[model samples]
Target: MKNTIYVLLLAFLTIPNLTAQDFSDIDKSPMDVTIIRNQNHSPMARVIYSRPSKNDRDIFGNLVPYGKVWRTGANEATEITIYNDMSISGQKIPAGTYSLYTIPNKTEWTIILNKNINIWGTASNYDSEKDLIRIKAPARTAAATIEDFSMAFQPIDNGANLLMGWDDTYVEIPFKNAE
Candidate 1:
């Protein structure tokens, strides 16, 4: 009985891939998170998104397409969490997590915050009725071509500008805390 148990243990240990985990390769578009902190170092807002590289492709109007709603990132739709009640472009938005969508154009972009956030990267899942706010942000030519889609926060008085850039186009949406 002891010998049989030892043999079984040895077979289990020698079994091919019996304990090995098969992990997939890294995602083509990498996920990222950006956050802004207030004067007290408390988080004001957070953005969870994926960065998609240019890969020598024409972004903006070509790949991303103008006048169409974009996921604002890759894979899943980009998500923004407002830590407090805030005003975006002078419109009030309650503190909550929402999906961030954008309709990019040559001169400007329409930034949309929707209550639905559980959907993947597809416009079919986007319901206009679920939209919370739609604000326009002016677009401009970047200093240089940005190889990857990126988002950042630039501190401003009483608020911050959520900056989005890809290729040679960029836009900034102002967000001010109501409280």
Candidate 2:
């Protein structure tokens, strides 16, 4: 019985190896997540996005272009999950997951949150009708260069600010908890 059990276990492990599927190489733009918590340590929001490196490319106007909607990240559309209802641009937004899109310009950027999720890219089939919130954030040159496209949350008194940085540019979208 002991011999039979040992043989069965070996076969089980070997079978998996034999049937194992090949995986493609790692993504050029790897996925990442960022979360922000309140002072009490309660989660406020979460962002899942792919970070594309600068790779010595001109990001703002040349590569990303101007006056066009971008997926806001690489590969997959960037997703943000809000844990609480928030106010943006003096409008209330209910807590939920939304795809983040942006129109980049030299002066400012139009940031958008859409109801649609799981979108692969915005080049072909981005539906503007599903947009829930649209806000403008002034673009500023970063004091230091950011090597990768990155998203982060900066805590505020009422809520927090969603910050996106790439190359030498950065933008901030302010969010305040709805009273």
Candidate 3:
């Protein structure tokens, strides 16, 4: 009997079981995608981000403090995937994936493209030197308040403009196809 108990305990400990738990009642942010396509109808660049709703909270000064590095979105460090080599804001960025960071201010926002892509938020492990490029984007006031954080790519001459908006604030990042 003792041997049977030991065997059963061992089997129970070694066996792997996964149980699904319902989390539908929890409030969660939804994932969003921003894609910049070429005239040929192919995606040249893309960003995978999480959209955090405002819910009447102050986004700029209170939620996201100025003079700090932000993830540019809600979660996962805001990944940027470049399908082709391009010149972004006078900087040559190679074809690869990168994490986008930004330092927001009243007048302008400094955009930082970093080599590190796997992260949670902000530049918590942010290394200034690891940044591939830094560019200044003028801050502008939107026509109306944007309840959800948003990112989109607007068409340009050869590439697209990366637009980010939240609350009543907005910024743009321009690029040109290098190929």
Candidate 4:
């Protein structure tokens, strides 16, 4: 009986795996810095985040579910740096680096700029007490699909329009330059 058990164990150990895992070659999301500059070509505000492709998947409500805190992008948590104090939505925010997070909904989205920085992924450890400001922004449906997640600055009179979009949906957070 002992010889039979040993023979069975030996046979099990001899089985081979048909596939190999190569972690080094796996593709990674690209890091991007989306910025807005003044007429002088100097950066006024910027967003540093990772860009994740849609890959033919639905983004809103499916990939990124509604009514939850999202990292605002892929990979590392999205970060925003302001060179000058600005008034966002209706809150006055000082010029500093902050962590950007969002809660998406069908009609509107809540945008948050927290004092927390250098963290990875969502508001897993989010402390609302550290939030500098939180405001609700209207959500819009894009006429065309955005294949990749993006944050852009559209220059206006005193400031630039902050735009976040993925798939066929988007939202805007307007900021007025404190100057």
Candidates in order have lDDT scores of 0.93, 0.92, 0.88, 0.88
TM-scores for every candidate against the unseen true structure: 0.87, 0.85, 0.83, 0.82
Runs off by more than 4 Å, candidate 1: 1-24
- Candidate 4 displacement at residue 25 in angstroms: 3.5
Winner on lDDT between 2 and 4 is 2
> Cα deviation of 50 in candidate 2 (Å)?
0.5
What's the residue-level lDDT of 10 in candidate 4?
Answer: 92
Candidate 3: tens digits of C-alpha lDDT, residues 25-120: 764668899897787889899999888888899888778889989988776788899998998877899999999999999889999899987888
Q: Evaluate candidate 1 by giving its C-alpha RMSD to the native, one decimal.
A: 3.1
TM-score of 3: 0.83
Error of 2 at 142 (Å): 0.3
lDDT, candidate 1, 1-179, per-residue tens: 99999999999888896666766877889999999999999999999999999999989889999999999999999999999999997899899999999999999999999999878995688888999999999999999999989999999999899999989999999999896
Q: Model 4, range 1-179, lDDT digits (tens) per residue?
A: 99999999998788765475668965566888989988898878999998889999978898899999898998778999998889987578898999999999989999999898988887476767888898999999988999989889888889988999998889988989875
**Model 2 residue 94 lDDT score:** 93
Rate residue 26 of model 3 by lDDT.
64
